[model samples]
Target: MPERASARRSSRSFAAFDWLSVLVAVLQPDGSVQYANAALEQMLGVSRRTLVGSDFSQYFTDPSLIQSAVAGTHSHDFAAVRFEAVLRRLHQDGIPVHVNLGVGELREHLVVELWPLEQQVRQDREERLLEQSQAHKELIRNLAHEIKNPLGGIRGAAQLLELELQSPELAEYTDVIVHEADRLQTLVDRLLAPHRHPHEVGDVNIHEVCERVRSLVLVEHPLGLKVLRDYDTSIPEFRGDRAQLIQAVLNIVQNAAQALAPRMAQGDACITLRTRVARQVTFGRQRYKLALELHVIDNGPGVPDAILDRIFYPLVSGREGGSGLGLTLAQTFVQQHHGLVECESVPGRTDFRILLPLP
Candidate 1:
């Protein structure tokens, strides 16, 4: 009995140490915060006095999430529930956040850990997108100025030479040059399309965007794959460019569908569209009150780890015959709206997440 008591005390001490290691730790009962760790205070830029005894929901854009967490802990038969909430830091702009909240009974209070879905991932994606967009813009400008003019001159000269030729074989060779120039023109136009198009910004319903993408995908791969919707109807419309968002989401879903092509013969291939409201996500060096979490999840062998990190880089592709600018263009469109995009892939699953700020 004495040894068992000692072991229990040791476990309790270790639990306390474990909590200290987390980025943020909170204790709540009846939706009020009873305790918070130093890291929690540091993360929020607030003092413990300002946190304790306060309703944790006050910081969240959706207070109902706390109620959901409390109810989740009571039933063992219930599946684990995940929720997204934005919490306000002491800063002027409340940081938009995405948390995978789970509840556990800790003594008399509920212990919860708040995970920042878009924070760690957001910063890196934004940097890459900015760099990639600039690089593409420069390349397009240079190509048009340096390459297009020269190609046009060459094609024009070839046409003149063909007209002057008495030999039919010589004319045929000139025709090839003109055809190649036409092909180059098409390639240049495709590379410039996203930047050249004017953004039409307005209120955008995320579900509408997903449905549009689903319809388009079905037209091509109708019988081969299942495109499913796992939506959170509670998500609100945000100020965004509707046409751009549609293209952004479409590109990702299309890529996922293409990835499943190889595995189509094996079994049922699936792509799921999921959305939820996330409060307080940091994007482009600023935090917003409400953000949307849209996910394109697919069941395939998964993106290989070797090139996964550079998947967003232009000209990087995992499939043969892929132009490789699909994801890069998608990332550019999302970032222009002050949002971020990220991907997580492993065996049996590949997920692409788009985090856009709500108005």
Candidate 2:
């Protein structure tokens, strides 16, 4: 083929495949990458110039697997091959992915597609979590209603008994009952707050929300703790409840600040509020072209593994004396805005990501 014609053909091919959502790469018979699409470059966290001409096997944890898969593409025994393998990336941990390998008869080159299993699993998990959250909200609302009436009766009876008591010492016992009943009522009110309150929707600037939370966190931890802002100035205001969004962000930042108590004592506590615009986000089974991504990241000892999964559940607190309703309320508020909140934690790092659709 002529050099200029071949160059045009290659550019056209890459342009045609660049818009694909899945990772794709054209490989030579020897398993060297000839061309990588945009999605593949983003997935590998590298540029096309760097990814192209590299050995395809270097990207996978098990090089022999890709080699065999590429070899199978050339074999007459199989028309196409699919297998699971761990993809290794520079300066990052390996990601388990499913690969589809096939040989293209037109170009006489091997084409490979990569799909991260973790991403699929994460999506499935998010769907389930949304469903579970709905169910939990319903249950909590009903349970709160059931307990509310009885709680009122208990508190009234305790007050009546206190008035009837002959001795002050005996009256103290009824006082204790009254106080406990009041506490229970408060707890029930909190459990039912999201359902009872009307959502007040208005234009919401995510940076304003972060700023409010930052101010509140700093007020609580004035010394030794540093709160940093990493805002994407290009993100425009969206429709949401400003107060609710502020509360949601505040709850997350408060939890992160509390988690950083140990680090604060060591004078190294740091929390970051990062905002970005994410494209092509799917939340609650609805796809949005643009969405707001706000991250509340902290450097702490991390959430305990045992309670990490249930951290957003009501009454499931990892800290002593914690009501455990912060994240629950945060999740509820974000859900009301048709958004999603997700958490990822390790020993030294914890990140809470809130995704909200933008108009």
Candidate 3:
């Protein structure tokens, strides 16, 4: 082959390669920028020209952490190290970015894959939550079946026993059994409702859904809890189960509202509904064409730490005398539509992100 022909083929192969993946990239030794994907560009709000020649550490909040990751990665035999460091994107914006650094010698240069730290964490969290939700569903089904028959027989026997007793105090004890059995039945019905009913899918305007939830929640609270909407007007319609999605979103927002009960009494409660379009989102180990990001943010005392990890588990509740199936059912419906649900909580702010795959 001629020299010119060989060089042309090599150029074509390099051009076809996907260098910028879902994470950030910073060249080692000099810490120069090789390339960043659309995700980084959108995140930093900067052009390729400005970022190409500069050091990526300048954008991070802690330059030392990046240096440590780089040195630690190179000192070993190309082992990856995880770091939780915030990026000082600009003067005003400091976004918390988790990064995993790994060094690979490629074409005589040490290339570092700046894996955006949250992607992996979010995936693991979603998988665990899904498993918990499914397990809850299975447990509920079995428990309901097992308990219903026995409760029926007990209630009947109690009625017959009540007749035989004739003592007022003994009859009251039978009434207690009947009342408790009825309550259990009602609880089981609520748990099985989603699986029993078929979801109605159609083109849904997300703004309308937010508006409906906003009105409903505001009407219920009516005083301290403020429901604010921050919707993207350019967001297009997608195929979704309108009623189910409404209920899912409503559940999350309502939970936030309930969390704000104390804050509301103190005039510090505010709930925000934020919407944006996300392209090429991966969910359930599969990438989607498009995804809708809906965030429910609250300015209140965050979720209790005791139940934080198990919030999606059935019967796990933060509130007194509350059933903890809201987040679980919300997750199930979202996952059914090929999406992911995520939560970030702290002392004053709690955000629940719902990512629904687009049509």
Candidate 4:
């Protein structure tokens, strides 16, 4: 009767850990799982009943790492030791996690905690990107406003100079000044474009946006480029600005076409428009139950490693004579919809993915 009561007391004590978000487990000195929390079961993609009494160390990439940690308890060492290890899931690839092992005084059982290291690193990167976006917005707005009026004055002065100059040499210099001023004006307008318009929110069908961009791109590049569509038709309409999304996607496609000029001449260029539903997605520091993943993929030389990280920043481009505002504008529009644009590239493939919440 006393042993049964002790087991009942242990069961109740173990139940207290079921609600934790972190994966927690109580293990014996020999590495057998005495109790597995709900989070641990979820992480392992298995049932608590099956997880308990199993050799917990077997689920890790290096089982000896876990066994060694458990062996520390035999020496009466209670200090938590931390190490990084890979946890093997039932149906998924192993995920890198930071493990903490220490013996709890209450039951003298080893308490093990496992948290995904990837999660913390991803969160840190997102935070840095958010901070960079805010800084870029402030810098662009201030710089554009500062340069706008002077550009007007310079253009006007050059016109006056052209009228006064009788010599062809002086007139050519005035033309150059006027042309450069006009170019600067156009750039300033693009820099301030995001702040000028109010974001119009309405029902948006992602496929419709994709078709519009596809048609526009095909019209521009009629000869060698083929635009293909692979869309998930079940994606529901979401609340967003339709025109902004169209423009954002269009910019990405246009950039790809421009980069594919070499392959286009060879008659082998292709751009694919793909969309699907993403569940439990986290980006821009917020988690969504569902999000739409729209990809603009192209077969071209990838983004230069030198400027890949800053492609979304103002005036950064990998191509010659490229204005570099396309990606910046696309990123701004997506951000207005509470989404983010990310890119992955290799030698012959480049994918620009835009993530937006779905209704």
RMSD each, Å = 14.3, 5.3, 5.4, 4.7
Stretches of candidate 1 off by over 4 Å are: 1-50, 53-129, 132-136, 166-168
Clashes in model 2: which pairs? Answer: none
What TM-score does model 2 achieve against the real structure? 0.75
- Selected candidate, larger TM-score, 2 vs 4: 4
lDDT ranking from best to worst?
A: 4, 2, 1, 3
| Model 3, span 1-359: residue lDDT tens | 69657544543443322333455554535666655544565556676557765787777777877776666666664456654666555523655665665555555234555556678777776677777777878888788778777877888888888889968998899999988988887787767777888878899998999999999999999987777788898888988898988889999998898888888898768999999988646667665546789999999889888888888777888988778888877877787777777888999999999998776
Ordering by TM-score: 4, 2, 3, 1
**lDDT tens digits, residues 1-359, model 1?**
99667644634543452234244444544667666665566567777677766777666777777667666664433444556667667464675556555667756556777666654565666666567767866776677567667887888999999889999988899999999999887766666777688888788888999999999998988776889999999887777889989998999998999899877666588999999887545656656657789999999889889879878777778998887878887887898888778899998899999988787
Q: List runs of model 4 lying over 4 Å from the truth.
A: 1-58, 62-81, 93-113
The candidate, 1 or 3, that scores higher on TM-score is 3
Judging by TM-score against the true structure, name the best candidate.
Answer: 4
Overall local distance difference test of candidate 2: 0.83
Q: What local lDDT score does residue 10 receive in model 1, on the 0 to 100 scale?
A: 39
Residue lDDT tens for model 2, 1-359: 59767755775776666756557788877788778877677667778888767898988878898888787776645767777777766634444445443444236777887766666677688889898898888888898899998998999998988888899999989989999998999999899888888988888888888888888889889988999999999999988899999989999999999888988999999999998998645567765668889999999989999998888888889999999888999999999999999999998899999999888
Instruction: Name the better of 1 and 4 by lDDT.
Output: 4
- Candidate 3: TM-score? 0.73
Candidate 1 has a TM-score of 0.66
Per-model TM against the reference: 0.66, 0.75, 0.73, 0.80
How displaced is residue 117 in candidate 3, in Å? 3.4
